[model samples]
Target: MPLRLPPLPALRFFEAAGRHQSFKLAAAELNVTPSAISHGIVGLEQALGVELFAREPRGISLTASGADYLSYVSEAFSLIAIGTQRLPNHRADRPIALSCAPTFASRWLLPRLAGFRARWPNVNVSVDTSHRQVGFPVDGFDFAVRMSRAPVAGTAWTRLFGERFVPVCSPAYLANLRDEQGNADLRRATLIHVNAASEDWQAWFDATGTEGIDTAAGLRVDTIQLAFEAAAMGLGVALGRRPLVDRDIDNGTLVQACAATIASTTAYWLVSAENADRRPELFDFKRWLVSEAEHFDTHANPADQALQSTAN
Candidate 1:
């Protein structure tokens, strides 16, 4: 006699939906349409002869049976993942997937990745720079870097670094400032703002004690990287974050428009599942990230202190 199983596809969809507590989110994780998720769940309910979800106007919720089913399904998947990871070739060839913010991916991590690659030549790394918050193992990401004011629950997370905002512009743009008076009359200059970091300019202004400038008047860009690029092209002065714009400043493409800087409440966090660091490659990457962040902090502290003093 052979053991029977429910439809695997339907089971998978059910698992995702159950775990996320939302069909739409499950669809996103599985890279399918919400209708597909709904159909799969419907088929699953029919196959099992049980009502798994309680449908509501806004969304769906798992019933008692669905909640119970989810635990077993999740454990089975975890076991399979662990089994595959134990394979020798799987360990060697599997790429570590990391999710990050687009601006941080381009402005900060991408520039520093060469060092990681040089040190670990055999370890493959894949980075996803979508704005969507990653769902960890379900989303197939080994880890993620997120900018957040507070730590996300259920995941092991480390603070990479806090952010500080300072006004930056192309040297040409600064030079073209009327009467070479630095940032004193910034109201007359074009301002570049990143929609994602909307509060930065106002924060900088408050810290510097500069008044009467309209913080909202600017060329709004979607990402800090785009704002930096615009400022580099002499489009406008942009409020740049420390560490992210350090390379541009080093290369002389961007210069401080003023001495004032504002510390941001938000910080970059490296987040992963509790067991993710058990893998040697992932552990190595985590260690390297911490070391890099430490190195940056050491160098940035002096300027940060000066900014703090001025703000005080």
Candidate 2:
């Protein structure tokens, strides 16, 4: 049979008091009165028939037995804290869940997620990468990052990155491309198509203001990263967001086809409940994202803090 133990409340109070060497500080952390903490510790000492603390003029100090007991208590409390931290990650409410388009999630968000974690270590990020529209109130998600041309009604939205489309292809594809007009020479190349986003091609066609080109006839993909990968593999041309494709463009893996890139009305937007507008975690994420976006616009590598300095 296992040995029965004293009440948990008494043991907890004693442990906190011993660790802090102050009932007042322990009461603050436990959200209890100082007197109550003192009483619980006194009750514990009475039960054990040992002097745990050496009462002093400035503050309390641990007795020989108390010092030994504190080592065990500290380890136990550390284990409890570790377990408690995991509970929030599993909890359904306020889950810090985010919804994003498949292409953006795979190509843009996932690649940069480590930076987000580095900034906010406590936040538990759950990503829902889908092309489908997510209604947050009906879906019970804490937040959603949507890529759209227009903001949805009845939702709080913050524009994450302005839309700027550039035609990008792998270095081999660019080398093989026969264009006397440099960047504007993409009219001869085969255009990659995103099946879900017919508008991207339509916008390109609109910007070119040319006719007799079929935008529908190419290797069709559903995700942005897939299209990008196809382009990177020297298969064909793909229109890419500046924020998502900037790194590839800079590193010589991809090259811009022209300076005719247009800033589209479409943009990456963060959507959430109005009540969560000022949430600290959400706010921190938003600020970081905006900072990165701005940095990328002015400079190439936003992650390299030194890049901006060299450019200036």
Candidate 3:
């Protein structure tokens, strides 16, 4: 017997709208207009001979029937997704898509990626670097590395590491700052500021008990990467995050200008949608990321080494 069913497009539209509980959000997820979503839901309701949503002054709400139908629809989609993921060839050639902050990508992750590639030669990885907050499935990102104090809502989160900030400058710049008494006077130095990380400098100053250095004065750059580069070029002293500037300090491009370190309230987090763990590749990637973060925290303490060197 031939089976009768609602239009696939209308069903898909209804599923999206019901899941999000907002037509506008559904439209964004489906890459269509709100009007189209409304029309599709209307057609779906007509086909089912029931009202799926109730029109209201502020927005729309799901009717009793719609809520019941949504449970079944959502379950069906989850089953389909899980089944597809379990297929033999599903992970064979598909790439893992990741989103990360630009400075973290360039300064921290990029250096370690070759190791990941070497370990998992068959698994291809693609990274997108941006400051915009990722929206998981809606934004088409498999997962993200975010700097935050806590876990993001509606996602599974793993804390990676905390941030430690220290003052850094080129060796030549530090040498030039030394007076006849051998005291490095930071008030006379040009402070390089990261526009987004203003608190870093303030915290460093408070920790070091230094005073009268103008926080507003400096060559302001938009990203930590640029600020580090400017400081390495002998422009001025820049507050450097430990993880990002570890290599630069080791390589002698930058030196610690101050011994005081400030521990940030926030830390790095690995975030992904609830369903991301179902795929074996994503699971493997997550485990690998956690391992790498642990290793970094254990072995990468350039800030401490820098302070010790200065004391000696």
**TM-scores for all candidates?**
0.75, 0.59, 0.70
lDDT of 3 by residue, 1-312 (tens): 999988988888888888777898888777899999999999989889999999998988899999999888766766666566667777557788899979889888888889988998989899988555455454456889887888867679999988888889999999999888886789889988888763668777786677898988889899999999999999999998987888898899998886767678889999975667777778889999999999887776664666646654
Q: In model 2, which regions exceed 4 Å deviation?
A: 1-94, 179-187, 277-312
The residue-by-residue lDDT of candidate 2 on 1-312, one tens digit each, is 998776679878877777567888778757899999988888878887888888888989889998887777656655564354346454423546678777667767777779988877877778887444443343345567776787888678777766567688887787667556453456567899887763587786687575777876777888777888888898898987667777788788888755456566777777875445445776777677667656654663343234323323
Per-residue CA lDDT of candidate 1, range 1-312, in tens?
998999888988988888888888888877999999999999989988999999999888889988998888877776666666656667566788899888788877888899999999999899998666565465667889888888978788889898888888999888777465434358777999888763678777776688988887879888888989999999999888887888899899999887667788888899985557678898999999878988987888898888667746
Models, CA RMSD each: 4.3, 20.7, 6.7
Report lDDT per candidate.
0.83, 0.70, 0.82
Backbone clash total for model 2 is 1
| Sequence-dependent TM-score of model 1 | 0.75
Candidate ranking (TM-score, best to worst): 1, 3, 2
